[model samples]
Target: MQSTAKAGPSHESVVTNGNGNGGAKSTPPTQRTALILYGSETGNAADLAAELASLTTRLHFRTTCQDLDSVSLRDLLKPTLIIFVVSTTGQGEFPQNARLFWRRLCSSALKAASLRKVRFVSFGLGDSSYPRYNVAHRMLCARMLQLGAGEVFERGEGNEQHPEGHSAGFREWIVGLREKIMQSFPLAEGVTPIADDVFLEPEWKLELATTDGTNGVMEGNVLPLRVANGHKSEPSSAAFSSKLDGTTGVVPNEDILPVKGAFTARLLSNKRLTAPDHFQDVRLLDLQLEEPYDYYPGAVAVVYPKNFPADVQDFIDLMKWQNFADKPLNVISTASKQLSPSPLRHLDLTHTHLTLRWLLENVLDIMSIPRRSFFASLAHFVGTATEDEAYQRERLLELANPELIDELWDYTTRPKRTILEVMMDFTMLKIPFEYVLTVLPMIKGRQFSIASGGAQRLDEGGSSMRVELLVAIADPPSPIIKYRRRYGVCTRYISSLQPGQQITIGLQPGYLDVKAEEMSVPILMIGPGTGVAPMRSMIHQRLAWARSMGLRTAGKRLEGDVLLFGCRSESADYFFKDEWHDLVEREGLTVWTAFSRPQTSTNAGVAGATDGDRTATRKQYVQDKIHEHASRVHEMLVKQNGKVYVCGSSGNMPKSVREAIADVFVECGASMAREQAEAYVDVMERDGRYKQETW
Candidate 1:
């Protein structure tokens, strides 16, 4: 829908971008505004919220959409319609982007009447497999209600395991929401809501400076270059440092990272885990913290990764944004909402002169797979004049259509097609430089489980502590684009690093909540592929506990710590295989392995192979091993109340593992029904006896 609201100020008048020209925001205020705040980890919740925001705009309401942390508590006090779409993250914790907002909401100073004028509704995205499922959505709703916000409709919950997935539930929820909006706040007579096919105006508007020779694409020195190891190094100093006031000057690298409490670390080791012929390349990275830092078992390190310089330049050239590449442009939020902690974020964007090249190279996520909202936005950029253009634009619109979700997934998500790849596919598509922020997603940090800590983490010199990460490089061939590959942007950045290279990393608390004091309780760990990282950390932590408990001589197996590790081949992807024998004999650790594809040359690598290990015949998976060791699992879980932790990729493995555990409960329990077995597993999850830290 075309906005009838009068422009309040020039683009330059608002925006307190660190640039010398920016000042306090001076745009129009909210009137009949619909605030849609989302908290997402995997971008699903944010994408859904963005889609709803566009729909709300089409319904003739002023819409403001952003992440939960971006807006202040005062914004919630506004007398307006509010909608929250939040995704539950690790355990029951709020997503990292939404933690600050959750903390603020928990303030004792907030009165019950603070949100008296706010009418709101909530939608949750979660997995039913989790005990504290949908906690993020539930917590927000309950808190808002306590603050006197009126509920306009019952909350809608989206389960990831639903037959059609979370998006299916959102499809149904949005349909009901549209009806509620019409009933609650009817549009004025003779004014109609925008058609479903129409595209809303971009929330962000960029104003270009006068076009001149100097403003066009600057060659070579657009970015500073330095040599390392007798070759040109990647932009490290100024790439992370942007002069927001638009100056091409270097600033102190003190605040190189946007996240608070981040520390610099140097790469000490980057060793490949898999064989050279392996389809996937896995690396075991050891990083030495330049400053002292502490993290517990299952803790994660969030690394901020940059795009490959060549890819960034390719994106600029592809868009024909040469003239605007080096030119500094002014950005203004045309809407009430300004993204702060989202992909469309305010981290380094504000501090720089805001050149197109700078945005691509340092800020934007050009390699991320475009969500459905991206296609909807892309539909606005291309024209439909010629037959070829019409077909391309029509297809983009089709992908954006709410009814064609399956088609959209088939075209984009399943193929893992990146934004740059999408643009390349549509030969006629060229988005305006001003709309780049709105079209492109921001470069978010990648989290890898800290694989090293405890005894191994501390150097023998007692001078340095190291944190390790097991990163599986993603560079698989694309199904749709046969000629191109799907190289993960963050993984690519990580793969290129050399020893002694410095980088900033953020630390995250783990959900396992394991304590060193729990020395008597046994623990069951199931880790496959790179998921073994966390399990490795826990083992190191257990070793430290053994030393502190004065049981070092016979301590490793004192608590009966068991790790059920799985991989495809013993000599190919079996991470940490060499250490198993030493751990079994010296540490008293029990290790079980499942090799889906065994090597023809030798047996599966179990240092002290038991009868069960020797008898394995055909291909086997982790879940199969769990079932084979059902009695032991039942003993540790039910009889002893030991904690069981599952760490792996999200797809079908977690669900299968949960089922295998439940099956064990059924087998062990006296006359236990299937329902009773499932219920018992649920209880274990509720009691925190069972925990999963999957992607």
Candidate 2:
């Protein structure tokens, strides 16, 4: 018998049942297929989905993983085991990648019983600090249930503030998920559970080819490729020839190239936006792109930073791998396990031969705070022969224990220490190279808001290119080590870069949901500090719009644009001060300034404030300003139907601003009670009139 299985929404593969004959065969039945879909903004949900796919594949199930946006509504009607890994973004909104899917799911045309035959499960990544924590996943589960889908297991919510971290909670949830899957789908005859001892199985084989002393010709014929299971093979040239003029050294094969999601960019300029004497260091950076990229006003630029050379060298010296650091080591899977459906397939290092130094410098995040599992793994390497080793081992084990999690946080997280420092402090533990790969997290990029308007002319030829960013240097106050100041990995690296220095950056879009046509409505922008990045872009865009429409300014008394900006003091940290003045004078834009720390008489004309600006004497905050203008704000919202946009610190600013807006409704007689006023504000958020991007 023959059966068709769906590997993904866009993929289908054929599976044969027993032998092609009617007679009973000794082969076990084909594994049931499973679908894993994810919606992610910062790639956390996608990472968790990939891990779940890997785990399920090892447990004798055919698995396929894809983004939720790729799955159509028709795919939801299929009778399959589906798992959703999704994350909530600002204000409990669905991630940009998942918006289309969510809209389709909420369609009125779809019947309530459309997915009655489907069985599904879900997991959410969220931060408990937010008011609408995990609302995205909760909404997803509710909609799925409304469509008559049967949930096989309880939905899992992974909180970032959890004692064991989101990853540990996800790991625990997967165990229960596997058991539920087994009970829901019975195994075929003669099928057996996989052994717990089997940790890794390889799918592809790699072999090193020697280069001849002459041209690029090899001494012997290239080895024939080994095909695993029934996987198809791509044809390749038997004799490799040099594409270069043969003057330069051998070029590495495409397989050994850096992993995807990386783009090389050159630094064009770096200018400090804040005064030299200011407490904070804010900078404006211009990056020259090697290739053309497109982004909107509020999109982010993710910069993949490298560890400091000194730090990398320190880690290598601590590992005592100086001799073997540059050695070419070929990796192949152990021959004991079956090669079909490869395990460890997600790791690129398994398919190529690379130096240990390259992996340490580019692959692993050795400076990040070590997780609980890392401590547990480190405990195994601590020798019990000496008294120090015994005590350290016991302590490491305690730190790894779930019961003593608070102590673990105090020792590792509170001090903001890195794994290298922990290893140096331990003194007796020596982790092996093989175990290092398993414990360390992958080094990822740091995201910053794109501060400039997209696509600027790079030359006289009118070739529009380059992107700009606003980055604030983060120098932690308390030193992790005595006399050694700790800097933010990405920010410090970018700050240290000189003009014409090359770096890798990637564009992340969809942060701004507003379209160009939506600029007709009145906009109220409230942003403080570097949060003004996106607001600046919006202001420039509005200026262009006004020029196009032949209007002198963006908005009038109640119909145009208004911006509320705040900082410590105008003179020291007044970002884009000249530009704001030009915009207010030429474009008829309305602006309000709040200086939190106004200068006193003794400190007049210092960094805090100057005599020219009278507003600096009041010492007011942005939230206080909002409350002071409650009547005008109410008029803009209720009488003019204006939109509100807030960008700034996530800690108390957003909550404070939200409460201040709610107070406006009550003071303006729009609502009788405070709860009703808050409800009105919530309604405005639901209608997309109130938007925020804070972090």
Candidate 3:
């Protein structure tokens, strides 16, 4: 989606003496305003920011909520207290929406004390499993501090690894958050914060199309939907007939998305990379673009998957919304009585049209486990006609209570109960049809790293522009529920694709940032499993560059390039094995293989020159292999001024791999003190010499 708005000059610029006016107490609570900005790859951070806005509003502060991309560093110069809610995506890079603002914040044009009066506290939503956990928020906080912005409170981190998930840490932070902000702008005389149970109006409101508004309302307290030269317009059913696909509204074709630019890609092939007997199912997809696309190894392909028809029908039946499922409703901004654009205008809907079933099937996520916020919101919508219904509503409210955290986990997370299942269980909960948009989270497009890129990655045979992806299917059987597997919405859809099937996709600039590097710059690559995808792309392109310069294919060809590949066995999941061997033999690229699942360790067999380890006694991972070859790794990194590119799962793999690299400096070549070695790596990361692309 595009940025909603541009950053204008500050309304009330306040220059402070580094510590005084950032959170100036002159303004009363009612006059005090808070600006909440979020950088969310998924809907998590945005949703959290919205909740925070609601809570802050109840405290008698006028609050404004927006995405980071919608504003700039200049916007922070205002006297208003700002709160940043950011999430790191794709190798610890800023999410797409936040990138522009982040770049502006980091620009060297501004003086060190540029944001001296910008008062803010930041909260990061992240998974600690990755090595660069909460790096985006941490960096933003550090940058703001460096630029002399006053911290209204110490920053907070919400780790998904917590037993109670992100909410656990959030609850703790929010307790301090409320207190901290309230202290900064104390409640006016005899005023107290509104009770938590008190209902607050939603930010967005829904209005049915009346006879006078059938063509779509454009004035007087209603949201205006404009097209072309900004002529006032509003949502109408005809918008659906012209723009949205029939029935599902998520059909895979042109005009499906990207009001600005979107293209179709036909599936050239969808081959399973993993062996049939292997427990994990992985597929290699080859998609040929209808338009000529740029070749970038680390770029991402954004895809939106459709929900299964059966699941959508089940949810409709549970909600008892079949009768009006097809009717369109105009969503107006409750907070902005003035004109505001609908978020989906980018979908080419001249006027927005939302049908209940159409939204459920194409826009709302019903398969993922429901968060506690879902329970809290749904409890307000329940109808307690009978004694059983009253008990169910009470149960829903109880689950929302922070005191019963474990109980909430059991009822939702542990069983992985989805929205549909929750609706089935709490039959008394009947959310009004118009309020569905506010209750349900928005569906976000999933991004998969492009596997194929470079000069040799294209076919000029007048057919298609090619991009590839290595995807692993997620369909494990549910632990508590039988007869159904926990299938991931996007991955499952990807696995069902057939050759020649065209789907809508957008190419996103990958975070790899390797394309501009010189061919002679050495690269130490560490990739296990499908992480090899980007590495393969870079290697081929590097080799192609060397060839273009008429250099020898061996030692002179992108000299010191090395790839450390780890997998279960040489026989299975040794993805692109033959290609690696060929590159080693012909292009002077060093390739190391670590096979973990073999029963016993096997000899090098080849004098430790060509093929890497044959087998390991116990399970050997990429980190283990990094240690064995630490000297060579240190030589490439320290002596040759090389770069390191690591790609893999965001789980413990990235953290373990990073620690192993740190160990290499102390134990192998550099032999510096532990702290110094870590500092060195940190410097490399800051300088962009060390990069990771873990999902």
Candidate 4:
């Protein structure tokens, strides 16, 4: 069932009112109906709700999943089960997609009455390293119970980040919920197969024109192109093929221009920072932007990445689908819903172009592994089926069953294994392609905290900005795949590019939630590793502003600024060592370091050579350092009136630091209430005094 009403009693109804005047509608009389309400960020929760509807429909139960914003309180009370799946984004808040739904679900008025008949189950998806891990899911469960909603199943939480093993806690928990439902609800009688199909067709008006004046290609229309065999790097033509055979496709446009005059920069310098003896290889990069691409010192430059040729080839080897090593194949949304739309939309077909090899290596996530069900499905087709395996056929059931597949690619029955190599063995693996394509989200661009305000220009008429970025080197321990040893996409791509390499990319201005004026407010920056990129820019801007105003104090006295950086060592992996020192010695800046494996006084001169006795100890990490200087950090915030910023891995150090700050607030003044302390934390975040950008 579908409802588009945005508000009022009719908006809350399941059945339309008899009046043709377009007014309130009456829902079916009180009956044994099931409501599948969802709060999703990237639609994961909604997808689950749909799947649940499918399952419920098979049991002959009426089901509906509605956006929380459009749902009425009366509708919620009628649900036999309320399942919620939500993701925690930036600062433990609701995902942007779920914000509106969450706001109404927790409204002050809804908490007043009992929702006694609602038998609900909630599953939350969150990264453990975040400070407010699973906070949204927890909030909904608590609120629902407070409203007297009956709990058929206890709330379940899943962690996306598990340093040691695959994180499928949520998936596992969900299986248990399914079993519980089967046991509780008897079959309603001879049930019909779930509707032929059930997926929302979100409307996209063509009025939102593309840069180039054309109706972007429709699905099923084939566009063939010839391209050279090379990496998905610049200079190589990147193209793919698709057909209009009952599918959707995004027409290829010669130009999808980014913002006008987007910043153009030169590769000032690049150098490897890691010691030759170390297993890992890291680099320090410096770039100089030309013209009006000026920056506000604290901003970061977003580098576009290209795939390595060798890695791309390996991925092609695994897919074994086609020698797309050279020839591009027709790509389509292998997705199920496009069939219904007579004139399929552009997105129904993803912009799937380029050779299968290019798609696997550069476009598709190579690191992801095939779902166990993918293996089970192929079992019947490839003649690889055994009597035991034949007993159970569904891919979903096999995936949940847990009989592991040996050699991940063997399951796919494909010649090569790109998915297993890229997303999984390198470190971790997301679900299979079907799941990723069906359940997960797309890979998004990384946002860096901008670092520098450009120095004054010779011509007073134009302006430009400077940005700093920390190059990230990735080296996954893989004896199986040698290509896994290279650096990451974005950072590695930037590191290899030459001075004159012109590139096309996008820039997302700061959400405007955080902004600072020149020379007016002091900023405290706490970033380790690449997180320091923006801090460097901020420091540069502060200095430029001071220089522009001619304010130079003797003991670094003008504006308040503090920078904390963490790394493996000082000599080898420390980024921008000299640049940071220059900011201090030459430009009067203060920079601090938290070396996790810094060379102790006794371990000096341990470079360029490997001594068997050269053992490094783990010193304090960024979080510990934060705790060590909590009092001073607090004084800087409360007394010095400074802002706090953080960047880096979202899972660990960032959460630790925030928790440490909370601890500091409590210890320094016990009299301050807990909510008051939380308020302070919130204040810092809301004001950009406390800000973060984590992966």
Give the top-scoring candidate (lDDT): 1
Clashes of 2: 1
User: What is the descending TM-score order?
Assistant: 3, 1, 2, 4
Candidate 3 ranges beyond 4 A from true positions:
1-30, 77-79, 89-93, 106-118, 127-133, 143-149, 160-165, 189-192, 208-213, 216-262, 335-346, 351-353, 460-463, 554-559, 599-609, 612-618
**Candidate achieving higher TM-score, 1 or 2:** 1
lDDT of 1 at 385: 71
Residues 393-511, candidate 1: write the lDDT tens digits: 88988887767878877877778888888888888777867667767887877889999857878877879878889999978776777866677777877777767777778777767
In candidate 2, which residue ranges exceed 4 Å CA deviation?
1-37, 46-83, 90-121, 127-132, 158-263, 329-353, 376-394, 426-428, 434-437, 454-461, 478-484, 551-559, 601-619, 670-672
Tell me how far the alpha carbon of residue 674 in candidate 1 is from the true structure, in angstroms, after superposition. 4.2
lDDT of 3 by residue, 251-292 (tens): 322224333466688888999988899888889998888788
Q: What is the lDDT of candidate 3?
A: 0.71
Candidate 2 C-alpha lDDT tens digits along 1-695 = 11111122111122211111101222233435567889987768877786666555544555557778878987665424688999988778887679999999999998999878777899999876455778999999999999998898899989876765576567567778887766666555666554322232222222332222111233222222222233422211111212322322221111222435556677789999898999888989988777767666677888766555456667778877665655443334323322122222333332333445555555567877776656755665666778998899888878876557577878877677788788788877666554445445666667887777622314235464577788889877653465556667677666666677677677777455656665667788898888888888777766655566555533432236777888898678878877766666655566776778865433322121112233246677788878877777888887888888888776677788888898888898644589998888888888888888776
TM-score of 4: 0.61
Each candidate's number of clashing pairs is: 6, 1, 1, 41
Candidate 1's C-alpha lDDT?
Answer: 0.72
Q: RMSD (Cα, Å) of candidate 3? A: 6.7
Give per-residue lDDT, candidate 1, residue 69. 89
What lDDT does model 2 reach?
0.65
Q: Which has the better TM-score: candidate 2, or candidate 3?
A: 3
